[model samples]
Target: MHLPSRPRVATRPVQLAPRPPQLVGRDETVAELRERLLGSDVRPAVVAVHGLGGVGKTSLTLEYAYRLQQEYDLVWQLPAAEPAVLSAAFARLAALMGLRELGADAADPVDQVHAALAARTDPWLLIFDNVPEAEALLPFLPPVGPGHVLVTSRSGRWPRDQGLELPVLDLVSAARLLLSSSGQDDEVAAADVVSELGALPLALEQAAAYMSETGLALSEYLDLLHHQRAELLAQGQAWGYRERVASTWQFAFERLARTSPQAIALLRLLSCYAHEAIPSHLLLSPLERWAPRELFRADVQRRRAYGRIPGPPARLLRDVHPSVLVMMRALPRDTLRINAALTALRRHSLIGPPVDGAVTVHRLVQAVTLDQLSRRVQRRWREVAAVLVEAVLPDDPGQKARWPRYARLLPHIRTVLGPTSPGMDKTARYLGASGDYRTARSLFQEIAAALAAALGPEEGATLTARHELALWTGEAGDPTAARDQYVALLPVYERVLGPRHPHTLTTRHNLAQWTGRAGDPVAARDQYAALIPIRRWVSGPEHPDTLTTQANLAQWTGQAGDAAAARDQYATLLPVRERVLGAGHPATVTTREQLAHWTARARP
Candidate 1:
């Protein structure tokens, strides 16, 4: 049967275009924000841009703020900080707009900020940057009016309709941005760079900036980037930025360690999975180990004091902070520590609030997080291979008899073991020797060259593998190839086990059968004649193998048209078979029947 080719998985990272200088690739988002700001239809009091950090939320809001500047008599950009600092900043905004406050604490600063916006008849625009919490800012947000308020945040609680989610740039926009930033006029090279960088605006920007600083061509920069992405992302000093991508992550990592140390460890643990998405339950094991009973009790007490939970179940103990979730989503693949990393993702709800028994992490995030996993976390990757091998092994009679199920999971087994694993070689031999000859043949050939290099030309295992390879080749309809393989193995077996050894005898017997199939009956007769005396010597006349070899020689003699010789041989073996076993025994009955048939044929 012809097997279909396995599908190849695309390993390249997805690329998105860079935001334009004025506006990136979010035309629809900008349009939606504009309509809500200017349109008379139930004008929302607040317009928000909500997403993960570095997703261009600030850029989108800034672009919209500039666009609506003419419509509003006053436009103010507010920096989000503590509530007290925000109130003070609002007071300063009132002073800048030339408003006199009657009392400092007539009401809360939130109420005061709202009153100030309400007092304005002229249309106004307020751009609030870096609002971390929706609840804290809710009191400060003014009621809906002709004026517009635009806010940017990393929080998930912002109103969805009014919120603009900034996804990464598409390929075309990303390519253009790389070309423009690197000052490269060649479209072809720029496109190549963008594709290689996965079209993420941040990655593209870093690549472009790297090229600009080093004065290297796009292709040369890409080669460097391919070899040294982690190194390049670590170079914040060269770029004059407070943090390069790597450092920004490290800052987040440090914060997580301080705030929620368990979650940080969980992030490292999750880095082990290879799948695009992993079930959330995989995190539970590490968390259970990391957070002990006494410490968990203390955490429950703290949450209870804070009124965070009404009851203390194990689930309550597992709740991860929102900030940690953001960090897990943002983590680069190579740097993620799998066991800790996945646990962190579960805690953060980045992957799941696992319903039932399963949850799936985003493939891209999972990949990036896995890339970040440390060597210690890599033990889990090895465990995963062992898990797959066990899961796919034929465990029942039906499974052993049915070849398709075993065939289907073979690739998964191969993938789990990886190409270079020592387990792969052992698995190949075990399957081949265990009667899954077809699969064994392919696996043997695949690893043979490597094994040859490592174990040398005349190794015992290599010779055995070649013998099996030949046997399967004959089964697969290549008798000549099988005959050649048997010939190759014959000398090796004789040298290793001696000519009269049982294994060597078996090899000779197989070679004779291949000789007959290859249309050389004379060679087959010679082999059978040699095996008959050897088998008789090894086990005497009563041995089943000796009798079987005699019977085989008799049948070949009959086929070669020597009926009298064949009858004589059959008559000699008949008493040995009858004396060794009962009449109903399968071998005894079969030999008696063969004698009758040869006797009848001779008479005719």
Candidate 2:
């Protein structure tokens, strides 16, 4: 008898990152995301689900992805907590798709992943989980063609058209989550628990876990929740918030502190920033970090030397301002060490996934961490953040090219320095430079008033702010008002900064510019002709300001009905404009066009 050969069965690996168990009350969310992924729109689409941390953003997104698992050929989850982590995830994906050649070196895995994604004929889904900021997620996002991208974040700042906010669950669903495995037959009892936990799924899950682990019933859990809320909430280990949502993560924090003290220390510093996106380079950027340590240790040692000393038996401690400096010099600068700490933090979810090039901590988490710090330590943390942000701030807010960098630090600037802080002047200047004249004008006016009061009339920062306010005020459409301000400011500039000083010259230039803009072309032309000599002498004939003044003079000369003079003036300036600013420079090009137009008009 001939035995039949065994049939061959081909097996292929299917990729799907395991999602959390027991999703409740997110059927609508899952359905909505699914529809978006499978929509008729052929263009690439991104759907971001956002809300407070621990509101089940990740769970909701994961559940949605799982439901549509069969509809796509590929499914991948990437951590968005840091740029490196995101890159690593992409590198892994690239390798999986046999694009390892692009991933092997220190190349950006995103490009390879993008190419692979574009090449795929099948539909796919990529979830950027725990994004810290919208900016951070952009680099890793593949070109939206054949694949659907879903982002889970705590930031509601994602583009409005593509984002869905996840709110806390309703009573019935919240109660159901708690009751699902409680074996508790009473829906009313579960509702009570849900109500006590504020109908938050994360909190409910923690409550359920605590009950299950400790063999407590719903009534018993309710008793603990009321009487020993903090202690009960601290019982379970999890990654998420540390307050409101705190109960669910207290254990994880304690464990993190034990397993990675550096992680806890990093969190302590991070807790000082706004409870939103925090730039990673602010920590790992190789700044002169030990300065903060030296300052801290000196303060601490001084306090130790005199702040508290042994006294009479009745009073064991005495307070004094101890007058000596002690140095710890303990702030770490090693990139590897900092990275290790960040890794530990991510493992514990103390910090969210990175967006752009930074990470974020939940507001509640920040609250909890700050609550744990001594007031003195908290102050030091704030001081450290201030120094770093101030250093990174763009040098000149007047340059449009610097606005993007300035904008990145704006939130941190507001956090480190109050609304009335002198730092806001520069921020406002940058705002104006970026074309937000309305906001710039308002901020400048407010800051100028406050500064004038605080620093008195003659302070430099105050006058500078006032000058900016007036400039933006003009840009926002009141040249006459701006001209008046410049007239008033000129005397002060001359008195304080002296004749020919840059500030004095700037005020003069502004005065003349607005004089013409206010409909006095004749006066402007005469003023510019006079100003051009002074500008040429002070800043050189080839200087930008000198050329600018000459151009203005030429324009107003034409506007004043001297077309022949304007034509001759422009022709004379054309060679200088080309020599100094290049032949194709916009100003040079405009000058040539002006000369040609004037010559054509004068030909008749």
Q: Write the per-residue lDDT of candidate 1 for residues 105-209, one digit (tens) a residue.
A: 454555555676677677777767767667777766777555677777655455555665555578788787778777897788778776655465556666667
**True-vs-predicted CA distance for residue 491, candidate 2, Å:** 2.4
Which 10-residue span in candidate 1 carries the lowest summed lDDT?
Answer: 1-10
Cα lDDT for residue 553, candidate 1: 80
Q: Put down candidate 2 lDDT per residue, 1-604, tens digits, no spaces.
A: 0111122222321344455677888898788887876673654678888765577887777777667767777777777767886787677767767777644875667887787788878877888887877888877778656888888876566666787777678888888887875656668778888766656666777776677777888888888767766456567533232334554356657876788776776676677777558886554453444444343343334323321212342232122112111101233356676677776676545676666768877655676676666667677666565545654565677887888777777777777754445456678878887888888898888877876776667777667877887799899899999988988898998899997998888888888888889899898888888888899889999998888888888888988888899899999999999999999999999999999987776675
- How accurate locally, in lDDT, is each candidate? 0.58, 0.70
Q: Can you give the lDDT of residue 448 in candidate 2? A: 77
What TM-score would candidate 1 get against the native?
0.54
Q: How many times do residue backbones clash in model 2?
A: 9
Off by over 4 Å in 1: 1-23, 32-48, 68-75, 81-85, 100-109, 118-125, 143-151, 155-165, 185-196, 236-242, 272-275, 279-417, 420-604
Pairs clashing within candidate 2: 80-353, 80-354, 81-353, 81-354, 82-354, 136-355, 136-356, 242-246, 243-246
Predicted candidate 2: what Cα RMSD to the true structure? 17.4
